[model samples]
Target: MAEGGIVRVRHCGAAIFCRRAPARCPACGSPLRGAGLPAAPVRLPGPFRHGHRQPRALLLRPAAGTFLGGYDGRSDLHVGVSSSQGVVYNYDEEGVHRAETGWEQCISIPLVQPDMFGLLQQWDKLLEEFSAGEDWLPHRYDEHDHNCYTYALAFVNSVLTAQGKQQMSKSEFTERFVIPRTKQASRYLTLHQELTAKDFYIVPLPDGENQG
Candidate 1:
């Protein structure tokens, strides 16, 4: 898989998108390996979904009505953690809630490998306890500072602490893990917007750019 949580496979001399690095391209059944990162955005199959059946993942999605689906980094987002059973634990104005729906609308960053059985066991329990804690009371939900992002980071730090690892601040985690994926998504959205508007979008390059 390439960086930014996307797998780019060369198919018919063009790149196609997948989240996992499959042995064969999902679109054409061709062997997929060492295709390298894509130079342009390609349409993914269906909507951009993640977190379903992905255990110990940090889930992210644009909040309702966000322009360009919040991949532009200028809008608010809803965040959550996924459990072994694909349930999402998140906080909002209504406080902590375990959700069985909405994973199909998210993009995920895996926080732990699935083979870590001991840690996976602890993850669900810790998530439950953290969600029920008093710091996440509905009355305390602050849109700008103490909302979903805060709650998600706190839970991630709790997991780090449990594993005797250094805990991460919100900015650290976001920069190190989240922003890359969002930037990839933003590129796709920008291309999609251009295609929707004009049916074709050409890259604007300086003189002699990429002329080999």
Candidate 2:
């Protein structure tokens, strides 16, 4: 199992990850099952570490101010991909940029486990060639219909094709991968804000919220 990774439990349809695992399921209070009884939860890395350490990752950052700067309690994000060299490739109003800086404030979602796709050596080259393609031209950028998310998704699909895997549509990818991770980020942000503003944060739950 990956260190501090997320776990999905089918027994109670619970997806929970934390620093320490409780003896019983936090949701249903059942004995934790699986190879790792106390499976570690994902610990979201600080931006500085994530940018320098996580290569071949899908990265997200607040589109405007810092994540905590959100007034409406939601994040509007910009998406990018990390090259094998740890440089970030993202599309925006200025077109695709190969960036070494400015990614120190992003979240990382791994595109694959280390060396899983057998393309680590060619990752940077592929990103460069793809970003230079006419489809991602600066003039073609659009905020809503075609934007950073589209650019990142396109690159991901290109890699999937090369890996001989079925390519995912935007909706499919967003629903399965992006949504779950983003939801986790949102929860983290909310709790952080609450704790920062007070001695402790008490999350008010709906009745039976933890019943599973």
Candidate 3:
């Protein structure tokens, strides 16, 4: 009989086929060998590797609002860095300032942990440098051009470029990063509005007081 072909035994009246070499027959206890069985399956490794580390947290907060008696709809942009402790740095009509944490919307971007602390330190140093200028002044709000959104774009791009990452332009940052991630109520506001509008600036909470 051919290898792995079924064989009928007259004595036990049973059919037997051996899939592996030297296998015992099920009905008669006789040894048999077969050569036509399929090979075993191979197991591939899993998608995720063991002991893989997760990326560090880098939070981006984008906020929008209308200042008192400015407009009916939200029409301003503010960006915040959560890497700093207990405060968000933003630029407004009053120029660059730090406020207690209450960003209207936030988006977390993963960054290399090793560089996070250094980047934050650089951010603080930049602010200090601006403060030390002989002609130090807050960024003035321009109706059709320079505004909060412009400040955010410049600040974020500066940090990104310093870290050897790709720098984003004002339009690119707004459309790709800020608009897509911001809340719906404030998402549609653009920098090129024909009518001028104002944005409500955040006030620092008193010491040891929490924002409600």
Which has the greatest lDDT? Answer: 1
TM-score for candidate 1: 0.71
* Residue runs of model 1 more than 4 Å from their true location after superposition: 1-47, 65-73, 204-212
Residues 1-212, candidate 1: write the lDDT tens digits. 11244434454444444454456654456565554443333435322455667778888877664333334556667888888788988899998888887666566788888677888778888888889899999999999889998999998898888889999977899899998878766776665554445523345344544221
**lDDT tens per residue, model 2, 87-108:** 8899999999888877765668
Q: Whole-model Cα lDDT per candidate?
A: 0.69, 0.69, 0.39
lDDT for 145 (candidate 3)? 70
For candidate 1, the lDDT comes to 0.69
Q: Tens-digit lDDT track for model 3 on 1-212? A: 11112122111232221222224434445443331232111122111111112122223433443221232343343444433343455555676565553542344433335656776456556644543443224545663576545655555666677779898877876686545445432322221121123221122344444211
Candidate 2 regions exceeding 4 Å error are 1-49, 69-72, 204-212
Question: In model 1, how large is the Cα lDDT of residue 175?
Answer: 95
Is candidate 1 or 3 superior in lDDT? 1
